[model samples]
Target chain A: MIAQFPALQVVIPLLGAPLCIILRRGALPWLIALLVSWAALAMAATLLSQVADGEIISYALGGWLAPLGIEYRIDTLNAFMLLLVAGTSSAVLPFAYKSVAKEIPQDRHYLFYSGFLLMLTGLLGMAITGDAFNVFVFIEISSLSSYAMIAMGRDRRALSAAFTYLVMGTVGATFFLIGVGLIYAVTGTLNMADLAERLPPLYQSRTVLAAFAFISVGILLKLALFPLHLWLPNAYTYAPSVVTAFLAATATKVAIYLLLRFGYTVFGAEFVFNIVPASEVLLTLALAGVIIASFVAIFQSDVKRLLAYSSVAQIGYIILGISYANVTGLTASIVHIFNHAVTKGALFLVMGCVAYAAGACRLESFAGLGKRMPLTMAAFVIAGLSLIGVPLTAGFISKWYLVLGAMEKGWWPVAAVILATSLLAAVYVWRVVEIAYFRDAPADAPPLSDPPLALLVPTWVLTGACVYFGIETSLSLGFAEQAAIQLMGGG
Target chain B: MKHHLIPRVIAKLTIPGILLFALYVQFHGDYGPGGGFQAGVIFGAGFILYGLVFGLENLRKVAPPQIVTAFIAVGVLLYGGVGVVSQILGANYLDYDVLSAVDHDGQHLGILLVELGVGITVAAVMMTIFMTFAGRLR
Candidate 1:
């Protein structure tokens, strides 16, 4: 029973999705989703503990041998990701109850929950599976459901957003499939561990190199890394508030997990850095993404779009950590996966609350909101501070590790870029703060209050986690370090 | 209207055969290339042909949106339920060897059930998507 935890972690949510539709009631599906999320969270926590001492749990489907069967392999890295993905969903679903109700029509409520659960299953399945092709299948499942959920947003533009995402996402997924197919064509095995062993010997082959390039570009697009990020801003901005919050926090983080998994685990650090100029390319892109995206974020009038661009910049920081290819650097990347998810989840949930109360997410809509919705606005401020990497917050801890990683590499300029970007982050965050606190509300502004406790509680839960994880640091940082060591040590 | 009669008659005559072939493809998946996905598409195509020939209103009357929506869930649940049953049998999830006394028997049972689940869901979802898109025209 205990050994089955790895499979149950994904299967529970996969089953819950269809169950939501079967029940066919508005609130019942939400209730089922909430329960499924908590169950997944508990499963993730257990998996993390099991893997804490550096043990790996491998469950073979249908009791077949691993190379021949689909495997759910758990180690420090995926376990940590499982915790992040599941934990974020658990936190976001409570807030989703109110925000979704307000944003989506009553009739489609069950469909929304079904889509949400399907997305959850996809993320969890992607993290858990050891078969490379399985990741593509799960990615499609999640991507398709997300398109549906995004299109369900009340705004007519939501349809275009979904369509755009569908186009970009299909291209990305196709590239990924092509890469996986190429690797399988070369190695004749789809299991990741087998590929890791088989790939190094074929590292010099052009076919392998092409496979790597395709996979990297596919993952970068999915991660919305800078130049490939055109589809994101509109998708996040136009999607319903709950959908925005959920995707903002979990989707890109999962994509980053794939980037790290393939780059370090499958490709091998020595081959990636020494054989190819992959590190240099990653470093260049990360720097560009941070600078360009942050500059763009500062000018956006729509708060959701602003945060969407901010998400691109934040992803740059994660890639920067990965580009270093050291233990501390990878730890920074791994830890930021959790820290950023919590921080961004809180910020987006706060935005959802504002949208719930004020009925818009435009910057002007936030004017004088600090007085009208103090608790909700305060949650935003705390989360925004974290985003700016203020001291004593989750964001600061990741940035600190990122800088230390840079200095460890004797890249002083890289460290400077890190700090400069924090200030850039501050500029964009302050733009909202000034609008919410200083400017007067418009004459036609409806009298607004803090969102219902259903929304506020989850927002603060994540907000409080941002500070708690920042101060404690042991859990997130500890797991991240262990996972980083495993990746760098070529697990 | 008179011109439509021939196509509608052909569709009515051929629909049962398409459905029968779909079932054959679905059940034959364990030993052959055909599987739930192929079967599901065939099943969906049969209904789509009915709609195209007899009109969508007639098709909806035959299948109905509510039941088609429910079938989607039922299919997935059927698939997932098999996994849960394996878990209950004291093996890992989807570990079909525990489903019966003979290991091969369990594998057969597990694969058949899961494929059935997949077939049902895919067919229903395909129909749903077609209806949603076509319904928008009205």
Candidate 2:
């Protein structure tokens, strides 16, 4: 069991999903999924310990040596990612039981759980796998399942959202495949470690540069970076609450992980930074995404859609860190990954709770939610404040590192830009705070109460996580630093 | 959905052949750019052909959508199952050599099982997606 930790990290959800369908009656599937997710979390914990202690665990598929066979590589970065993904799934599954039954039809309940499990499988697999092509395969797995999961929403907009995601996802996947193909054509290898070793020699090759371009574009689209983020707002707005929460926490996080893996692990900083000037493009787009998307978020009438735009802005903070192209920059970006996941996951889950209680969650619907659904709205306020980078919160920690990294590079303007964007976040969050707390509920509305514990527990779990990770830096930042050093080739 | 022969036969022969080719690619994964994923899709294509030629109803009779979906889960589980087996054997995930007394031959078997898992999942997922879309068409 100890030796098989890598496989267990992915296998639990991959296998547990069918068991969900089979044991569809009663609360069994949820229980199974919960147990399996915990198992995965345990595996991740063990892997994290091993990696943090500076041990790299590479599991050979069927005992074939790497550069020839599929492998599950565990280092500090991916181990942390696996923990985030599995931890989120475990956290979310407990909440999904009643929430899903309320949102989805009874007969299709089994299908929904199964799809959820598969999506989990795809995400965790992508995070943990070392093979390049395997990432694409898992991307399809997660993407296809996610499309189905999102489409299961009661609203007709769900279908259109799913369709739009499908088209965009297909395009992203195609780009990723082309990039993989190009890399393979150049080096005849698909393993990340092998690619990293082989790619430096070919740094001057136009073909390698083309591959880098394709991969960056593909990841940018997937991460919903700046101008490429058109598909995200609708998908988030229209998806079933559970689906929205899951994707908010895990999906984009995984894509960011891909970008990190490629930029730092596969391409190496020297070549990627010095050769192609990738950081300049990343920086420009990050700034645009942060400023522009924040403004867009401010005007949205629908609360969920507002947060969706806000997500694009958050993505900018992560990209800005990466574009700095140093240990501090990479660490900052990585820290934000965990921070944003905590913030967004809590925010969206609270939104789901609001939707459940009020049967609506637009800006107007939330006009007096603070008074009616006090705890839920309070959770939202806390998470929203964190997103604004308030001191003593997870979001601030990320922004702090980002600013330091920028200042270290003597890019004071970039540091100023980071401060300015944090202000944008404050404005949008304040808008929501004003509406939810200050205004009046419609006279026709019935008195609303707190959402059930099933939902609120997970909501608070992440809320607690945001503060806990903020106060206790050892878990989040330490892992991120180790991951950064590892990506910089164990500096 | 009703079954029609021309399309069915074409689906049966072509889809099965494509699946076989996918398996070949998966087995030859180390030597080439393809592996478990291609095999999974090809296998999926075969079952999809079965559904196409025999009518989804008839195919459902053979492997119902619910059951097909279950099978898809089973396939991934089977892959994971191998990992568990390796754990029980006190080795790392998918350690095939431990599965067999032979050295590298165990790895051969391990890869085969893992590929089979991917093949099953890919095949079943295709069927599941097909069922969803075909229903929409209806």
Candidate 3:
């Protein structure tokens, strides 16, 4: 059973999803989803522990041989990713129970849970699978379900948001598929490990270079990297709050993991860096994403859209770390993945509560929220602080490492930009704080209290994690260090 | 209202044959090109034909929406259950080799069960999608 942890990790959710729809009663689907998410979290924990000593755990589906059959491969990098993805789901689902009830119509509850599970399954499958083609399949699975989930939002614009996401996501998936096809054409294998072994010799081939270009662009679009991020703000803002929280935290993070996996693990850093000048391109884009997105975020009136743009900026930090192509840089990127997920998940949950109690997520809706919903607003403040990389927070640790990575490369301007962007983050976060605390509630406003305990508790748990992991730093940083080493060591 | 006797008669005649072929495709998947996905679509097509000629009201009578929704979950559960069963037998999840003493027999058994599960879910979901869209029309 322990040996099968990798498969069990994904199968439990895959199985539990259908069970959610089968039961099809109020709260039952949420309960089932909650249990399944927790179960997946436990499995991910076990898998991470198993791989903690830097051992790779590979499980062949149906007992078939690797390269000929599907394989679930767990390394330090994927193990960390699995934990992040599953942990975010576990944390977010509890909050989702109340949020979903308020946001989605009753008849669609079962479909919501089912779509959530399918999305979970897709993300886990993508992180665990060793086959390049399997990643594409899982991407589609998650993408299709997310489209459904996003469209479930009560807002009429949810339909357009889902449609826009669908069109863009399909193009991204197609590009990724074409890249995988080219790799297979040259190497005659779809297994990542097999391709890794075969690809080095073909590094100079135009086909391989074209494959890299397609795959990178596809993944960057999926990650919502700067300039390619037009679809994200509305998609995240208009989608049901739970969908926004989940996708904001995990979806782009998974895309970043793919970028790391393909860029470093499969393509090899030397070829990706020295041969193609990918680092410079990524660095330029990362800088632009951080500065431009942060500036854009500062001007947004919708809080969700603000955070959505902030997400693009945070992703820039992750990409910037990766562009350095050093252990510290990669470690910063990996650690930021977990940190940003915890921080954004908490912030979004708070926004959901505000939407629940106040009936809107616009900046003005936050007026006097600090008084009406003190704990909820406080949770937002803490997460907001983390977002700005204030000291004694998870965000600080990631930025610290990111700056260290920049300085190590003697890129002082990049380091300066990193700090300057945090100040921009501070400006945006402070806008919310000022509105929530300083402004008074309107005279005719309905009495609003903190959200129900079901929602509030989960929001705080993630907020607590943001602070806890920041101070402790052992679990997240330890895993991230090992993951960075593994990536740099060529897996 | 027109009875449309010719179309109704053709639908009535072909629906049973279509369903039978769907089952054949599902079960013969391991040895042939057709599998659960193909089988599910074919099965759903038969019901769609019935609804087109006999009316959705009559189709719903044959396959209630509530039961169809449950069927969707049941199929996925059936597929996942096989994997869980293998895990209980002390093999990896979805490790079908441990399902039977004979390796080849276990493989065949596992494939059959999984394909059946896929066929059931896909067919039910397709029907449910049609019902939802058609319900909107009414």
Candidate 4:
């Protein structure tokens, strides 16, 4: 049973999905998904603990040897991601019940839960798998389900948003396939660890360069980095509230991990920074995404859309850390991967609670939410403080590492730019707070109460995590540091 | 014989032309970087075209989604299963030399099974996706 932990990490949700669909009763699937996700989280923690102590767990499917067979390899880097993904999924499931009921019709609820579970299975599999081609397979499984989940929104525009996402997602997946094909040609192996060993010898080859270009572009599209992010805002806005929360918390974080894994580990830091011009491109885009997305977020009428755009900007901070391309920089990127997931999950879950109470998430809909739903709004406020990187929040720790990394590189301008972006974040988050607290309530609005405990508990759980992890850097920063060292060392 | 013969003949002749190209790429995989995935897709496309022209009900009679899904899992299982066998034979996971009753034969046999597994999984999943979408429309 202990030896099977790696397979169990994926098999639980992968098998649990069809079982969820078969059961098809109200609340049952959600409960089952919650249990399975928590199981995965526990497994992930054990794996991460093992890896942090310098152990690598490689589980072969059916006992096949590597360089010829598929492998699931767990190191500090992937184990951290496995924990982030599974942890977020379990947290989001409790909230999904009420939120899904309110937004998705009863008839479609079972399918929605099924899709959610399948998406979880795909994401976890992607994060944990050691084979490069397996990543593409899991990515497609997740993307197809994601498109379906997004389109299930009651809003008609959800359809078009899903369609646009499909087109872009397919193109991205294809690009990744092309890159894998090229790598396979050069190294004759699909296992990532083997490729890392084989690629450095062929570092000067044009073929490897082509593979890097394809994979980088593919991952960039999936991460929804600034220029390639056109499909995200509408998709987030139009999705059912539960779907948006799940994706915002988990999906892009997986993409960022994939980017870091490939760029730093598989390709090596020297090849990434020296041979390819990834650093400069990442820096320019990070700055633009932060400044432009913040300005855009301030003006949005719809709250979900505003947060969606804010997500794009937040991704910039992660990329900015990577652009620094050093130990502190990599640590910043990795730490933020965990911190941002907590902050955004809390914020979006709170948004869902408010929408459940007020019947809408438009900025004006929150006119008097401060009084109507004190607890949920407080969660929002705490999460907002995290978003702005206020002290004693997880967001601040990620930013501190980022700023330190920039200063270490003697890039004072970059450090200044990061500080300036935090100020812009303050402005947008302040706009939401002012509307909720200070504006007069709409006269016709009926009195409302706080969201049911089922939703609020998970919302506060993540908000609590945001603050807890902020004060306790031992786990997040320690895990991040070890992972960064592994990444920098090309392990 | 005529009823089965006509479709079989058309399939045998035309499908071979298409699959001939697929096999070319599958074998050329090691040399020029093409392999099981492309070959599998091409072979699956032939079956899909058969279903489309001959109606899905007819296709389902021969190969259903349940079977396809099972094949998908089994394909992965087969791939994984091979690795376990190698380990039991006193080698690391996927060490093909352990695969043979004799030494050198193991590499070729291992590669064949791996590719066969890839081809099976790819084709099955392709058909499964098509069936799922078609079912949604209905």
Please provide, for model 3 over A374-482, each residue's C-alpha lDDT reduced to its tens digit, 9 standing for 90 to 100: 9999999999999999999999999999999999999999999999999999999999999999999898989999989999999999999999989999999999999
Between prediction 2 and prediction 3, the one with superior DockQ is 3
Interface C-alpha root-mean-square deviation, candidates in order: 1.0, 2.1, 1.1, 6.0
- Summing lDDT over every window of 10 consecutive residues in candidate 1 chain A, give the lowest-scoring window: A57-66
Ranking by DockQ: 1, 3, 2, 4
Cα lDDT, all candidates: 0.92, 0.86, 0.92, 0.86
Angstrom error of the Cα, residue B33, model 2: value is 19
> Model 3: which residue pairs collide?
none
Q: Candidate 1: deviation at residue A420, Å?
A: 1.5
After TM-score superposition, what is the CA distance of residue A443 in candidate 4 from its true location, in Å? Answer: 0.8
lDDT of 4 by residue, A1-491 (tens): 55667777886677667556556677887888889888999999888888888678998765565767778998998899999999998898888888888898897776787788789989998998989999999999899999999999878999999999999988888999999999999989898988988899999999999999999899989999998899899888998888888899889889999999899778889899998999999999988998899889988888899899999999988999999999999999999989999999999999889888887889988888888888988999999999999999999999999999999999989899888888988988888889889987889989988999998999999999999999999999999999999888777
**Candidate with maximal TM-score:** 3
Task: Give the TM-score of each candidate.
Answer: 0.97, 0.89, 0.98, 0.83
Residue range with the least summed lDDT across 10 consecutive positions in model 2 chain B: B1-10
All candidates' chain B TM-scores are 0.96, 0.76, 0.97, 0.78
- CAPRI accuracy category, model 4: incorrect
- Those runs of model 3 whose alpha carbons end farther than 4 Å from true positions after fitting are none
Candidate 2 local lDDT, A301-403, one digit each (tens): 9989999999999998899999998889999999999999889999999988987888766888888888988989889988988898888889888989999
Q: Residues A207-271, candidate 1, lDDT per residue (tens digit)?
A: 99999999989999999998999999999999988888889988999999999889888888888
Worst 10 residues of 2 chain A by lDDT: A482-491
CA RMSD of each candidate after superposition: 1.5, 4.1, 1.4, 5.7
